[model samples]
Target: MNWIHSSKRFFNNFQREILAFIHRKNLGKLSPLYDDSKWEPGHWYAEHYQRHFAPLRLKKLKILEIGVGGYDDPKAGGRSLRMWKKYFRNSLIYGIDLVKKKALEENRIKIFQGSQTDESFLRDVLAETGGLDIIIEDGSSSNEAHIKTFKTLFPALNEGGIYAAENIHHSYWPSLSGERWSSLAKGSIFLENWIGCGGSLDLNDPKTLMNMYKRLVDGLNYQDFLRPGYSPSYFDKHIVSIHFYPNLVILYKGNNDKPSNFIENNALRPFVLEKLGVESLEELGLEFSLDNSTPECTHLELSKR
Candidate 1:
């Protein structure tokens, strides 16, 4: 068939579903999809997924992404919706968006029309789906939407499943700058209540997130933290960034009592790789370190609720 004609992201088995998701989001927000010309991986969603999705495997995974059915984003392109259907066949896929019936494959893809701020709706979905293996928040770019999802759905993810939100640039949207920690900011509104492992966001004060926001803003700098020239866009607007790039970030869902410490600056950032006698960012072109590998990481951990 035309499988060979597909993009390089597509292989004999894997089809790059996230790329498809990106393109579709781009379409709903921006323009129309013509010839799958909207997205380019190295550019859009690269920093996030490069290390974000490599949780080791995608086979037989269950995935969900909020805020679907939009125009192409400056980063993700069109045909992204359909592309997801192609790549992640082994997995059961579900999506939610402001508008209904617009997600790429409605027949094969389970979709819901809703808002992330709707806790009842979110909890209901999770109840039915059990727990998602990978949950993406590319849905409504609203601050409240983000906060709501963080407060609610993230708790429903499997122990090792990932919960991510994209286009957090809106958190730092210039128009929203002064209003950052205001009642309107999503993280400010919701994340405040999550308890930390040493700090989880679950049992937080709700108002405390603003304080974290202050710390996040303080850390927002293109600092020369590591030995290599790697820096992740964090693709986030709230903080200057998460960790350096060429490496991905892994934030643990520590415990209901305390939040995960990975949210803070990397203690490893200051140690020069040269002095430590390493090559690249850890001598590997990876986004994280040995301690920060899959199941065990110093920066992230859920002690238990």
Candidate 2:
């Protein structure tokens, strides 16, 4: 029976390698391969990932995905890791999970066991990987975990790399809060009451992962912010673009040094009025009663200087 199972596994792996080679040769759709796997259906993520990943299919890359599937079962997961392996022929695939999935280790694939929010664990993983070309946050699916893991691992992502968060709809679920729930008998409440209390669904909540990423959108235009002695956050200086999809967000990492057309050194240039086809606010049918005491007016006056 062991021999039979080994033969079957070998045959499956060989078949997949052949299919993957043909798929790469023909520029085939990834949806079929995703649908064939236990990771997820093609409709959920394959197309969106294809749009972003297809270009890099031939590149030798190191990719990390958080949360190997099958939960606490050590030997039962690695479906998505296998999918990624087939998809990126030239790439090495790595997965992190709380469970030790040493059984899933294969050629060009590795697994690490640790909390996603642990910087030390992640740093050690990076030591082995050198640096990551892509990172997919599919762990735990809690708001706090998303934010913390991103903060920990994003800095290690290579320049021009891609960082993606998956299952972000969990950010809106009341059940999965910033931390995992112990049980309803302890401190957790009923779903109805949780919703009634605004729960994690509140868009204004800073603790939610979606809101955290939304804040990064402003960082994309950090140069346009008008303030004295303004300093750009690390994200503001590095996050070049962010794309939102259903249950997913992809952030492109690179130099975000594009200066604002109308501003330089955090001061509005006088030529901005000319660019707007107006010499002054009055010409543009706009009026402001400047009050020197107000910070708004002070910035305005400073811009004029």
- Give the number of the best model, judged by TM-score: 2
Candidate 2 global TM-score: 0.76
Model 2 weakest 10-residue run by lDDT: 296-305
Write one digit per residue (lDDT tens) for candidate 1, span 1-305: 46656744356225333344454333322222233322343224543453455443346776787655443332222244444444454677777765554435554567666666776676566666776667766655444545556546655656556655554334432222334444444543122211110222333223332222333332343232232332333212122223322212223332222222322233333244556676445554556432311111011122222
The weakest ten consecutive residues by lDDT in model 1 span 292-301
- TM-score (all chains, Cα) for each model: 0.46, 0.76
Runs of candidate 1 with Cα error greater than 4 angstroms are 1-43, 54-58, 71-79, 102-108, 174-305
Those runs of model 2 whose alpha carbons end farther than 4 Å from true positions after fitting are: 1-18, 25-43, 176-199, 270-305
lDDT of each: 0.44, 0.71
TM-score, model 1 to reference: 0.46
